[model samples]
Target: MTDPRWGEAFSTAFAQLTALWPDKVAIGAAVSGLCALMETDVALAYICFGALTADMTARVAVCCKRNRPLCRGLKRALPRYVCYLVFIVMAWAAQVAFQRGLHVGLPIVDIMLAYLILTDMASIIGHLHYLGVPVPPVLKWLVFGGREQLKRKAREAAGRERR
Candidate 1:
């Protein structure tokens, strides 16, 4: 049988080890939060890109239906999409390295994720426009500098050249 003194000593050691329980709990929560954020960012990125790809593919099919087969457009677009996916993955890896390896803060990761989301949204908008959605001119201008805006600028430049 264990001695009563030994039991008392074990309880004392256990109590001492658990004295900083709050700090340990805080650290665990923080790590768990960071992991969840990383996972969510990745999932969001994938969803955004997937939607963008589908929209773009549909736009290509519609645009090329008269001139070329849909399969040809898909063949051409597949490599470009693959390249974009690779770029996104590399960027994500760099962000992770900055956070984990270099001990960078969360704001940088947040900024990168925001940038990814905005760009994906913009591309999706552009594709929607190509698919004949009547997206607002102001929104197009805000997101893409507007095709009409570029045409107007070109016309202004031509008028100045005429002078």
Candidate 2:
């Protein structure tokens, strides 16, 4: 299983990143993955997922069309290309770190799980924000806590039943 703390950290990081740059960074990262995915079979499915994210960006672009302030602000901040470059480099670094047993401090899978959680949280929050929905901070935190609590409760209940 993945470390729960990673997801929490990821969510926090994602929230901050999205708050700063909105969807441009995310769309760029997704596009970068698509470029790489086209070159590898094992990664092709992930590339398709990236393409779906690009679609989301297109939607956001449409939604923000009339909001010139938000549009120009997001456009001027960062290039999607840089974000995509960072995404690939990070993935490569993580793989290298794993191969070198850098994950001795924690399982590599757990680290990956953390990034996944962070990414998912970022995506959902960005999407909600894009649609002008009010995403509650308490509710966002619960996304991390609820699953762990449910799992723990289930385990305890199972143990009791066995006894």
Candidate 3:
């Protein structure tokens, strides 16, 4: 006959294992989902970085055409690029932590990414305008502000100058 103590020990071990199985499965699923989300975010960040680099290149080209010192323009731009890169990385990390740890449903990361994209687009549009490319007035209004706002500001400045 089988020993009673051995049967009891085996049953106890199986019960404990089964009890912990759901927790393990939950943790595994969370980690898997987080990894997938992180991968998507990384790809998007790379695209944002590419846009920023293009903007920087356009600025440098403008500076070069204007007979400015290339080194000075690059020196001014390099720090800004580095800061943006750091911001992207930090934003990714913070987003992951908040979304997973705090269970936040807010779209903070999406807003940040959109802001970066819009800023780069505005810079590119400005550079194109400087290069004598005829960007549509509507684009300028959309990216910078409405034409009425600009006119108002100009009128205010002129009014101040007369005083």
Candidate 4:
């Protein structure tokens, strides 16, 4: 049996990892850029970036407590990632309004938004399996299998607890 301390260590490590992942940083960058574009102020934009990061970090903590390893997985994070899309749309609208010109020029924002959304969704699908959340068969084949691993560990942990 794993030591209780191991679980704590794992939790701490995973929490730190989730906070520092590339996807989260990209989301923060989106918020930062949006604030910068809207206010014409770099500092204010960075402040907004920091706020979003902090908020996400808190949410991760909540998710960890509520769902454990499954929360740390991608499925839960994927749904939550929808917020990033909302941020992008809001930013685009603000930019269009501020410029007062119908400039739909392609920007780095589009690429970032697309990559972030796709990657986050992929992770979420994997995590959903860990939680035994039924994903469509089409998606199940696409995601890395996590259901059995999570289920085995969950059952083992429960057995230990009952002993």
Candidate 5:
């Protein structure tokens, strides 16, 4: 029989995921094995999760403020390309976790789960923002708190572009 703890962990993770995005049950399933590791190791998993979450938020806020077809310029786009590289590496790791969780194992799965969970949450939040949904004020201050610097940079870039 499968461990009851596994079921418990999956259920809790699934509930949390659905709370973030109503259709995230599949994503929850994808990361469920990693969730099991989270149940086993709380502090480390959460710290990694928080780090990835912050990283992703900054990327999203920056990208949202950028021009479309993101990689247009050589010099001006270097920072955005760096963020893209970070995203690509994280995505590759998530694929490894989903495809080879059995072979690669715990710490890999744990870290990937944190990254996947937070990325999934960020996607949902970005979609809601695009749809004109209002963010909860507390969440705004927490997740988007660093946006002022990004805004300043964007304005500086705009002034340069107009010159």
Candidate 6:
């Protein structure tokens, strides 16, 4: 018979790993860009990038619980992710509006995807900030203004909890 404690440990490890999967996929998207072969299909590459970035943004939202909108029980983080989804939809719609309505020369796919890359970077850095991880100078400015914003948010949350 399998040891119950061992089974519990395995279950816990699996849960943690599953929770981390989105972050790993985001890192994979970054590493994929380094591969010359993937560049051959530029359109597909951009689509993949767009999809990954949208997912990463939502996943990052799911990761940061303290600052998230209030929801209850098993699906508390879900509403927060929905907010990120709205941002993704709006971004795509803006790209369409800019290209079709205004008759700009911009490629909608490329522009929207490139914008999503920036958004993903911001979310990734934000996640790092929430985790108390050290981030580089560029990402610092891009995400939280050198952790001061994070510190302020933390202080605000503490004050609220004290009340």
lDDT of 2 by residue, 64-141 (tens): 765655555356333543554465456556555645653322222233333444444555566666667798988767
lDDT of 1 by residue, 1-163 (tens): 8557988899999998799899988876765565465554545555545755775666575658447677776776567567655655565576677568757543333344445455555766766766677888777666555434444654674476446
Highest-lDDT candidate: 3
lDDT of each residue in 19-111, candidate 4, tens digit only? 789988897787667555644344533443444444445445556756656446345445544676576666566556534654433333343
Question: Candidate 6 overall Cα lDDT vs. reference?
Answer: 0.54
On the 0 to 100 scale, the lDDT of residue 1 in model 5 is 75
TM-score of each: 0.47, 0.34, 0.56, 0.29, 0.27, 0.34
lDDT of 3 by residue, 26-61 (tens): 976764564366544544565666778888898899
**3 in model 2: Cα distance from truth in Å?**
54
The residue-level lDDT of candidate 6 at 84 comes to 44
User: Which stretch of 10 consecutive residues in model 6 shows the poorest summed lDDT?
Assistant: 34-43
Model 5 steric clash total: 0
TM-score head-to-head 1 vs 5, winner: 1
Quote the positional error of residue 152 for candidate 5 in Å.
24
The digit string of per-residue lDDT tens for model 6 on 1-163 reads 8557988899999999999999999976764653332222355445545655554555545545656543332253345446544554564565567556765433433333444445555666666666677888876575445345544654674476446
Kindly give the stretch of ten consecutive residues in candidate 4 with the minimal lDDT sum: 104-113
The pairs that clash in candidate 6 are: none
Off by over 4 Å in 4: 1-39, 70-82, 85-89, 92-95, 98-163
Please give the range of 10 consecutive residues that has the lowest summed lDDT in model 2.
104-113
Q: lDDT, candidate 6, residue 156?
A: 76
TM-score of candidate 2 versus the correct structure, residues matched by position: 0.34
CA lDDT, candidate 6, residue 137: 82
What's the distance in Å from true for residue 35, model 3?
8.6
**Per-residue lDDT of model 5, residues 44-134, tens digit only:** 3455455545544544555566654334333343464356436545645654664475353334334444444444455546656664778
Sort the candidates on lDDT, descending order.
3, 1, 6, 4, 2, 5
